[model samples]
Every structure is written in C-alpha cells, then in structure tokens.
Target: MWCWLYFYIFLVISQILYFSSLFFLFKVMDVFIEFQILCFNSVNVEMAVFLDWVSLMFSSFVFLISSMIILYSKSYMVKDKNLDRFVYIMVLFVLSMMVVIMSSNLVFVLLGWDGLGLVSYILVIYYQNIKSYNAGMLTALSNRVGDSALLVGIALMMGLGGWGYSSYMGDFFLDMNLIMFSVLIVLASFTKSAQIPFSSWLPAAMAAPTPVSALVHSSTLVTAGVYLLFRFSNLLSRESFMVFMYLSLFTMFMAGLAANFEFDLKKVIALSTLSQLGMMMVIFFLGSEDLAFFHLLMHALFKALLFMCAGVIIHSVGGCQDIRYMGGLVQAFPISSACFGVSSLALCGLPFLSGFYSKDLVVEVFSMSGMGLFIYLMFFFSVGLTVSYSMRLLIYVFIGQFNVLSLINLNEKDSSLMLKSMMFLLVLVIFKGSILGWMSFSTPYFIVLPFSMKLMTLLMILFGSLFGLDVLFSGVGQSSSMFGFIHFSLFVSGMWNLPVLSTSSLNSFTLNLGKLYLKNMEFGWAEFYGSKGGFNLISMILYEGLSVIRNHLKIYLLLMWGFLVFIVLLAIV
Candidate 1:
C-alpha cells in the first residue's frame, strides 16, 4: 500500500467492501465497538461507530481521496528529506478524520477532532518557517475555539443523556436545555467550518503543503465541523440556526470576493473552498442533510483534484505560486492544464459536472423553501464570483502571453505519481456528480418557482463568465486594483482579518486581564493583606514586645499580676 498505485487500489477495494457491506443491512444501525477498559459504571464511554448510507459514503470518499493525496505527495514531496515524517503526519490526519466520521461517541469524536487540530498544526508548520508557524498557530487557536465549544456542547448533551450520538434519539430531546445545546453545537460548527469570524484561519492554513491544503480544505479538518453539525441535526434546527445561516451566507460572499482578488494560487483555491463550505452550511440549515453531505463528498473530489493540479503548476514553475508570474501554461503542460480546467469549471458548477449535481439542487431547494430573498441573492452572487475567479484564474495562467522571465526554462515535471493521482480524481470530477445524485436521492428535490427566478442561477453564471473574461483581458490585473474597489478588496481578501482579530483581540484581552490580576491580587493585596503579611506583622510584634519585656521584667510581671487580680475580683463578684 505504500507504493504509489498500490495505495489507490487498496483504497478502492476498501471503499467497495465498506459500501457493499451497507446494502446487506435493511435499516439504520448504530454499532458500538466498545472498549471495556474505557468504561466507568453505566457510562460505557465506548468506541461507537454509526453505520448509515451517509457515513458510509463520506467515509469511503475520505479514504479514496486520502489515498490519492498520499500518492500525489510521494511525488510532490520526493525532494524533501523529511518525506517520511510528512507521510506519517498525513496518515495520522486520515486516522483522526476517520475517527470523526465513524465514531458515534462524542468523546471518541473529540479524540479524533483534537487529533486533527494537533496534526494540522504540525503539517501547517511543516515548512518550519516563521510564516508557517504563524499560520499554524492561527489554524490551531481558531479551531481550538470550536474544539472547546464541542466539549461544552458534549457536557451539555450529557444533561439529556450519555455522550453517544444515539443517546440523543427518542426521549433525549425532552431532557435537553435546547437553547444552550443547540447554540453551542452551532458555535462549534461555525469555528470548525470557518463560517465568518473563524474564517481567517482557513486561508492562513494554506501555508501548509498543497497536499495538506487539499486534504484539510477538501475532506479532513474544515469539513469536520459541517459533518459534526450534520451528525447533530436533531439538536441544531432552531431560531439560533438562522444566525449561522446568515453567517454562512456572508462567508460564501466574502470568500468568493476574496478568491477573485487573491494573487496566490493556493490562497485563491483556499478561498474557493471556504465559499463551498458556506454553501454546505446553507444546505444543512435549509433542512437538506442529504444534499449537504452529497455536496461535501463531491466537493472533496473536485477540490482535491484542483489543488493537485495547482501543485503541479506550482512545482513545474520553479515554486512560483503567484498567478501574476504565470501565463500560457496550457502550451507547456497540456495534461496538467487540462486537469485544472476541468477542476475549475466543476468548481463553477458547470452543467453535467460534479458540482452541478449538488450545487444546482441546493439553489433549487432555496427557491421553493420560502426563505428570505437576501439568502437567495447572496448564494447566487457567490456562485457568480465562483465562476469569475475560476475564469480569472484560467485566463491568468492557461491563456495569455507568457509572463515569465525569459531566461527561466519551464516545462512539465511529468511525474507519473502526480499525473496518475490527478487522473483518478479527474475521473471523479467528471462522473462523481451523477453517481452521487443517483445514489443520494431516489427522487429529485421538487421545487416550483417562476421562470425568471429559476433562470437567476443561469444568468449569474453567464454574468460571472463575462466578468472573468474582462478580468482576463484587463492586462495582468494588479492585486491593488482588483474588483475596482481597493478597500473592499483588502477587507474581503483578508477575510476581514479575522485571524488577527481572533488571535490578537483574544490574546490582548487575556494579557491585560493577567496583568491586572498580577498587579492587584498577587503583588498588591496578596503581599500586604494575605497570610504572609499577617505572619510578618505577628513576628515583628513578638520580637519587639519580647525584647521590651525582657528588658523590663519587673514591669512586665507587675502588669501580669494586676491583670490576674482584676480577673479574680470580677469572678468573685
């Protein structure tokens, strides 16, 4: 399995076997593979696995994509001396993600959840550079918020029942503090999924290897939050759920705008990933868990392929990641360029592609659900932006005058490991949509809307294409002049700088509070009025009084005698 093609084959077989196993069972089943050692009294605290069509499909896709990434990394990281360590970290990330996917026990999920946080931090800083360190810290701390929220949510869930997911079924809903339980779960999901305020970390995490970015953005870390919320669908639908839905809308909009302005190849893709996550959250909130999960799996396939294609371009171009420094790449590397083209169009929800299947359904569901107009507008605008940036990316890199230094030779790496991995995902990028649409829905989502509103999606797709073509022809568009609004560009492109806000704002307050505590409690009041001060005062009095008494022994004796006589007289009276 360590061999390049061997791992892909093994993963394919495992996916087939696991998916096939689900058919023999007639109904939903929760399987608890318990560890007796972890149990205490009635709280068994077991390794519980939930088996359903959703779990099977998502888990299978995770492993399938992970196997492809491992093969891709074998070639991408072949030059690094620590390739072994990189592989180990990637393996651990997969295991952690599997735990999240398969475990029904909340504690077991945390085990995997924390594993993702810790390992992603390690991977993000794998470059061992200061930038990577800062990015890793932002990623870790931002996700820490979600992880802690999950912990609190888990504790809150215990009020209703045990920590296993199945415990939330039946009479559990009657016992819960609905507000706290629901809100905490949403907050946790928001952070993990990088909805709005927690979004800065997702882009920052692009400092990791492209494979890690592909894994994190596609199937692993970021998706953990959405998957979790889906798992807790019973606990999440409420008034508070609308708050996250709006946040997701803003995220989708913000990321779409940012990806258009971003010059970095990887960062652009990262923002694109963020926007799609927003779409998934909306699908979940709209009461379509099946559609959300379906999009998630399909997104994992195409997005991974997209990043892998980007990796090839980045590697072949002598590590230059800025799109401004690249152009006419289709002439040089036709194969890689073709893969990227398919991946980008799929991202834009080009008809008959993977994204088209789930994305179109999401929009249709929104039209018929009687939701507010604002949500519908934001979603379509983001979809337009999706195509705009994708077209902008294509124009900048694949179709234009060569924008490289004349002396620097450029050609395809032709690494078979990389090519084969991309080819595998390319197949999915083309076919997975149809496969998932058929498998996930026995009957299509039926929605009735006027022709004008129904054509909104198509119109936006057209408008976004034209905008992208304009961007392509605009003469190597500078980052500063992007979107024709510099300030808004910076605001959106920087993800509202939430990374700095989340980290610095939080750290600043905590630091100030610490200083106040040290000054007043530790140094001032504790020193003067606490035990040490009292002991010191008593010791000084004893020393001074004892010396005076020794020097004036007769006077001291007279005083003691008078006091004793007074006490005796009072007693007699």
Candidate 2:
C-alpha cells in the first residue's frame, strides 16, 4: 500500500511538472486566453477561466510546492492508518488553491476561497483532539470573516452588473460603491492573510500535520489573501493602502519579536511565515506588485523547504517540538541539519540565496521610498529581529548540548523519501533566487542610495546575530532582572495576548452571555409565564376542586338519593 501511494505521488508530481512547464511557456509567450465554461441566460450567471502569466506562474509555484509536500508526506505519514484520506484531502486543498489562482470572476473566487477554508479546517482537525479542534475553529472562523467580506463585495459588484476583475477597476477612488467594495476586498485580504488581529490563527494552525503547515504557510492558505490584494492592487485607494501599510509593518515587527521568545519549533516557523507575509503586504502597498509577487514566490520556495526540515527534525526527536529539548542534532542528522541551516539562511536573506534577491530588493525599495524615520528604522529593526530568532533556532537545535533523554530513539536513515523531498527544495532555495528574479522583473530596479543607507541592512544583520548570542547567554540563570523581562516575554511571545483576546476573553464574554440567556429565557420569566406557569395553574385548580368535593360529599349524596325517589314515583303515577 505504501509503495502504491509513493507511485501515485510520483505520477502526480510528473503531471504537475508537465503542466507547470506548459504554463511557463504560455507565460513567456505573453498569451492570454479566456475560456467560457458555462453561461446562464436568464440570471446571467457565468463561469470562465482567465489564463495569463500572473495566474499561470502563481499556479505553477503553488503546484510545485504542493508536489514536494505530498512527496514528503508519503514518508512522513506512512505510519498513519488514514494516509489515503490525508493524501486525498491534501490534493483537494491544492485544487481549491488552483481555482482561486485561475479564476478572474469574484463569485468563483469566493467559491474557491470557501473551499480553502473548509478543507483547511479539515486538515487542522485531522488529529481529532481538543487542541486540533480549537485550532480548526479559529482557522475556519477567521477565514469566514474573509468569506463574508467577499460575499458583500460580490453583492456590491452586482449593482454594476458584473463580477469580473475589471468590474472593480473604474471610478474606484471617487464612487462610494467602488470605494466600499475596495474596502471590503482589503478586509477580506486581511482576514485570510492572518494580518494584525487575525494573526492568532496562524500559529494556532500549527496543530495540523507538518505537511499541511508547509503547504499552508507557503502557497495555498495564507497566500490567498495576498494574491487577492495583488489582483485588486490598482483599485485600492491611498487611504486604504496607507492604513494597511502601517498595520502590515506592525505585524512584521510583532511576529519577529514573538519568534525569538517562542520555544516551539513549528510555531517559530509559523511566526516567520507571518513576518514574511507582512513584508509582502508592505512591499505591495509601496507600489511594487512585481516585487511583492516576486518575494511571494521566493518565500514559497524556502519557507516550504524550511518547514520540511523542521518536520524531519521533529519526527526524529520522538515528536518533540520544543527547541529547549532539542540540541546537538547536527551529528545525528547531517542532511536534515544542513537543509535546515540553508533554509534558515535563506529566510534571513543571506546574500545570493533565494530570499536575498527579493528581500534585498524590498529593503532597497523601502529605503528609496520617501518614508518617515520611524517606519524606516522599525522596518530594518524587524529585519534584524528575523536574523536574531533564526540564529537562536540554529544555536538551540544544532550548537547546544544534547538535552533529550538518553533512551529516546533518534534516526534519520529511514526517512529517505523525506530527505529526497528536502533535497529538491534545497536546490531551489539555493539557485531559484536569480532565476525567479530575472523572470519576474523584465528590467532591474536601479536605486542609487548613500553608502550608509545601503550598509544599514548588513549592520542590522550583524547586530541581530550578536543579539541572538546575547539571548543564549542571558538564558543561563540570569535571575537578577527576570521579573520585568518575564512579563515582557509573555507579552511579545503571546502576540500581545491576542490569542487570549481573540479566544479566551471573547469566549468568556460570549459564554457568560449564553448562560444569562439560558437563565432568563428557559429558567426565568419565560418558564414562569409559559409552560411551567400553565402547569402550576392547572394543578392548583384541580387541587381546589377536589377539596370542595371532599368537603360536601355526605350532603350531596343524600340530595341525589331523594331526587331519584321522587322521579320514580312521578313515573308510576
């Protein structure tokens, strides 16, 4: 059965590769085709496919990363009894992302959008535990907000008599309807991308199997929002752009800060994904859609690779995900360690790697833009935070002493297929930067900046590395000043108590409201006046009638006997 599943995965990979290559050619030829699938005459319902470089290239990258994830999952989930079901659900998830990527109509986009939310909920709760259930609920409910926003946007578009991408274009800034629609689109994107207040779900979503995390954080689930924004970039008003721009910047800063304090391996990676997503949104709003999309693709490559490596390490460590319990793994798992290190470097935007090309461009572009001093320094500082946490990850997992129990088994040899999948992405993480950069940008961006401005990025990286080392050293029983530091760590690591705010705080209020409703409606006045009151009244009336009959029983019987005798005599006469 496992062999057959492997064969199936390889077959799917080959087919996806063939189509992706074909799509690449289509992209190169600058071809655009719209194929109408169905049209309704009376209500004017229509379904059509929009083929272009944007959709095709995005689809190709999504498919490529999904293929690797599936390959990795074949071995990663081989021991599971529901492996077949897992594979099927994963494929369905990928197909839904394809629909979102290729559809130009808002209605179909919503359809695909809802599909992603539904299937992701399934994947998140696949373990059928309380944690998974909670995570699934958070993931679904957060995306549901986006779904509603899209529904409202579609309804708003109905006034204009079209649901196509072009319908959202004209008179966007002046017309109230168009501006409202644009706001709805931005709101939908925010929820789906897990931006700002919606961000608690991203780390909570780590309850899912690692493969799902890789696919989700990289290409399908979270990217759906950014892609939606990319499609509607031209329609966004300056006010909306500026508002979200600052929010996205804060998201980057917050996630980077949180990752340094986090101990869970998967969640740290999840936070990194959020940080990168914020960066994408920031660059997108800065008037470089191409750079945003470019970064998205590059991010997908290395992030997927990063998650896969994390998965391997987690699997080898007897399901341990805490980096504190994981140390000195490099000697036990050489290949996985190397892949993880390279992916981390790529994530830190090491020069010439896949991430550097896009990240450097983002920094250069942000520097070139006429922005305020605070945003500028905060942006670079956030970049430094990224390096700090990544270095912390390396130090904890590789350079530190072995911290796990001696009896725990650790093996890397059996995960041949998993390693192979990692190798595939490792190659991409190394070389895909230049390839994608050239393909994405027809002409390079020439930004002339002062030396100090250009050197700031490197300086931040160095400072961040030193900070990471400081974090390691400071962790050694430094009890003199831990009181305030502990409180601060709790705030940042807990995403400023967002999980509690989004879940527990709101939940407590809602549950209290429900209890009050139950008391008032069912146990209070409603019960007293409705069925319970009626039953009591009927019982009281019956009790009174029975008492009166018992009191007058003797007299009533005598009267009845006398009347019977009189009636008998009259009949005889």
Candidate 3:
C-alpha cells in the first residue's frame, strides 16, 4: 500500500516535471545526453538518452497511466496471495517501457523491448493454471518473432555505422540498405503490435490479471511497435508503405468483427485494443506520425480506463468473463458502468472526448489526402464496424437482460481501489485530448469538405451502431440454438477463424505432426535401429559370427570373387 502511494507520488511529480520541461525548457533547447561505455576498433558503444518534447510527453503519459494501473491492481488483485509479486512485475514492466520511451539508442530500446515481452509473459501466466501457461506461451512465442526481427534490424542498422537512432534520423534516405532496414523494422513492429497473424496472442494474453491487461494492452507493450514505427517513419516510407497500410486496415476490420461476435468480456476489450492498434498504425502510415502519436497517447488514456472499468464489472460478476452472463451491471456498479460507457464512447470516437480529438484529426487528414477509394472505404467501414461492436458490447453489458446467477454476490461495496484509479483515468480520458492536442501540435489542420464527405464518419458510425444493436439485441452475445448462422458467425466473429488459425488450429496441426514424427521417426525408426534393439542385434551378430558366416559363405565367396574381378579390371586399366 505504501509502495503504491510512493510510486504514485513519484509519477505525479514526474509528469509535472515533464510538462514543465516540454513547455519551458524544451522550448529553448532539447536534451541529449550520452555516456560512452565501450570502444572497439574505433567503434563507440554508448548509452544515450534523448529527451525532447516527444519523449517527455510520452514518458509522462506512460507514467500517468502506470500509476493508475498500479493503484487499480491494488483492488483487482486484493484476493491474490501474490500481490507484491504482481506489483513488482508491473513496476518492472513500466520501467522497461520508460527505457523504451527515453532511449535514443536502438540497443537500449531492445533491452526495454525484450523486457516488456518477458515481463508480460510472466504476468500472463501469473495465475499458474494450464490455461494461463498456454496463453503465456502463445504470447511469448508470438512476441519472440518480433524480437528476432528487431535483432536483425539492429544488425542491419549497424551496417550504417552506428546504433543510435538520433544520428541516423535525417539520413534515412541515404542509407544503402533502406529497404531491408525498413522491412525488418516494420516486421518487428508488426509482431510487437499484434498485427495480422501475430494478432492472436493479444487476445490470448487476456488470461493474465486484469491490471496486467490494462497495463500491457493500454500504453506500454503493444504501443511499443507503433512507437518504433513512428520513430522510424522516415525510414519506412519507400516501397513497403502500402503494405503496412493494408495490414493495418485488415487488422482493424478483423478485430471489429471478432469483438462483435465475442461473448467473453475481456476478449472483446482485447480485440478492441487490437483494432485500435491498427487505427494508430494506419494513422502513422498516412504521413502524420505526430497525429498518430497523438492518438497513441489518447488511446492509452481511454483504453486503460475501458479495461479497468471492465475489470470492475468482471469482479462484480464474481469472475464471470462471459458478457452473456452479465447484464444490468449498471444498476449495481454505476460508477464502473459510467466509466465503461464513457471509455467505450471515447473508443468509438465520440466528439470532444480524448479519442475524438485524435480520431477526428486522423479521418480529416485522410479525407484531405486525396487517397484512393480503397483507403477511404477501409477506414470508414472499420469505423462503422467499431461502432457496431461497441454498441453490441453495451447491449450485452448494460442494457440487456440481467443474466447473472441469482446467488452471485453482485454488490457495489469495496470499489475504492478500482474507483480511485478509474476516477483518475476518467479525468484524463475526458480532458487529455484538449490538453495534449494543445501541447503536442501548434498548427490546426485545415480540412474543407463537401456535405456528404463531412457526414461520412457520422453516417458510418450510425449505420454500424444500428447494425450492431439490431443483431446483438436479437441475442448474439447470448447463447442460441441457431445453428444455421453458426458458421457465418464463427467466420466473422472469430476474425474469419484468425485467432484459431494462428493459435489453436495451427497448434493442433503442429502438435499432431510432431506426434506423427515421434511415432514414425524418432520413436519408430531411430528407436528400432539406433537403440537397444539395434544394440542387441549387433551383439547377436557378433556372438554368432561363425554360424552367420557359414550360412552366408556362398554369398561371401561370390562377393570376394566379384571384388577380385573388379580389382583386376582396375589394375589392368
């Protein structure tokens, strides 16, 4: 308790200092400090810290959200015996995230990168159950792909003669291996951000405690990928840019579909996080890394609140994670319900909220870009689908029938920890848009549009909202005997079987193949010929050499005669 209090105080002070620096000190000059650590053959290895407006602001946001998560975990993990360990891991995770935020050296970023992955794996399996372990493995291995790619990118970056990103920022165009470097970095970001095939693990990681989910999914780990891409946006623009755009679009759409179909509360939020990550990636691809960064920070604020509010609901429902088992929770936990409702609105880009400021800017920016119909359709359609799922979720959680068990203790008592943390985030979720919007960017974008174009986002949002409410209100999140729609539902709701393809189905196939290999090769042929049986056979042959030789005497004589003839032929030649 005291620890969280001190940590909260530290973060509050840290955020103030950062805000002060951004407004005052950084306006004069940036801070770039480095310590030379090693040298080899005229090559210098240094630990570099670069704090300009970006780092200061981002680090402050991270700490702000982190302090809230730590406080939230106090209530969330109150019953767990491993509370201290949980908080420790979260603190370490935040520290790792800060390292990623503050460092100008790619190597230091990797240290934080791997640290986030490792600590998240630990957090995911904190429950110590088979489910948690499996989820943890999936999360870790999926992340390992990105980590390996990042290492390769670092190796390739070394070819440019240094590992410090600040030195190479303006020279991205002159790099000889720009394509390879960009591809590797994009690939790394893709895995870390849970894009496409790597997307399964983010939802799977919901097996962790809710606090960890809020911390990991909100601002720190998944956003690490987008942060990397933003930092290297200059380097990734050539040739491979369209690919990231398409990937982000698909990820956004897929997550929206899956979340609409999902019954599990945590998984829905998790998929929404996946969708929002895609949104940020798309914004980054659209040539406004600053706006993307803006959305990233805003997303962290509201998404953290969304997950925490969901946690309070999950807790109130006596650990019931299925939204079908939840309803009328608003009547029991009004504050949590309020927080969830607002955060979901913020997530759906409600006007004047934290999400609105960045999301509106992104849509307007894209509209002005004169991009193709494909880009416009993908962005707007995904926006609509987002509203669809958000409405669907609201129906299941707040407006639908109260389907929870009658005997379950759904009380409003003992929400102090959750309420305190959520209330803090709630304030940020409301005002951070205006606050950061003013602080981060000075010039407002000029967007002139026709009437239809102006109403596009709203119309799409309305369509998706009606579509989601109509379908889900008719009982989608609840159990049904409608087997006809099952396949279509599975395809759409399961992300076209994406998470299954990436996780269960794929794992099953690989495990079966491994079993077959063990049966046919390792345990079958190798065991037969390379083990005790083969040894016995060799021993028998050695012991019965005279008898075996007598039986094969005619064959041996023929072989000797053929050998002699061959030798004679060779000698004659």
Residue by residue across 217-237, what tens digits does model 1's lDDT show?
A: 888888998899889898654
TM-score per candidate, in order? 0.85, 0.88, 0.87
List candidate 2 segments past 4 Å from native. Answer: 1-43, 171-174, 476-487, 523-573
True-structure lDDT of candidate 3: 0.83
Ranking by lDDT: 2, 3, 1
lDDT of 3 at 319: 87
Superior by lDDT: candidate 1 or candidate 3: 3
Q: How accurate is candidate 2 locally (lDDT)?
A: 0.86
lDDT of 1 at 288: 86
Worst 10 residues of 3 by lDDT: 477-486
- Write candidate 3's Cα lDDT for 1-573 as tens digits: 744774667578667856765774337557889998887766667899987777777777778888888877877788888788777888889889888888888888889999999999999999899999989999898888888888887887776566887787667667777888888888889999999878888888999988889888888999999998887776674678778888888999889877878888989999999998998888787788888888898899888998898888888777889888887777888888888889999998999999999998888888887878987888898888889888888878888788888646676578797898898889889997987777667667778988899899999999888778766755543444233453467677767666678777768978999999989988887888788688999888887886767779787888999999999999999
Which lDDT values do the candidates have, in the order given? Answer: 0.82, 0.86, 0.83
After superposition on all C-alphas, the RMSD of every candidate to the true structure, in Å, is 7.5, 4.8, 8.3
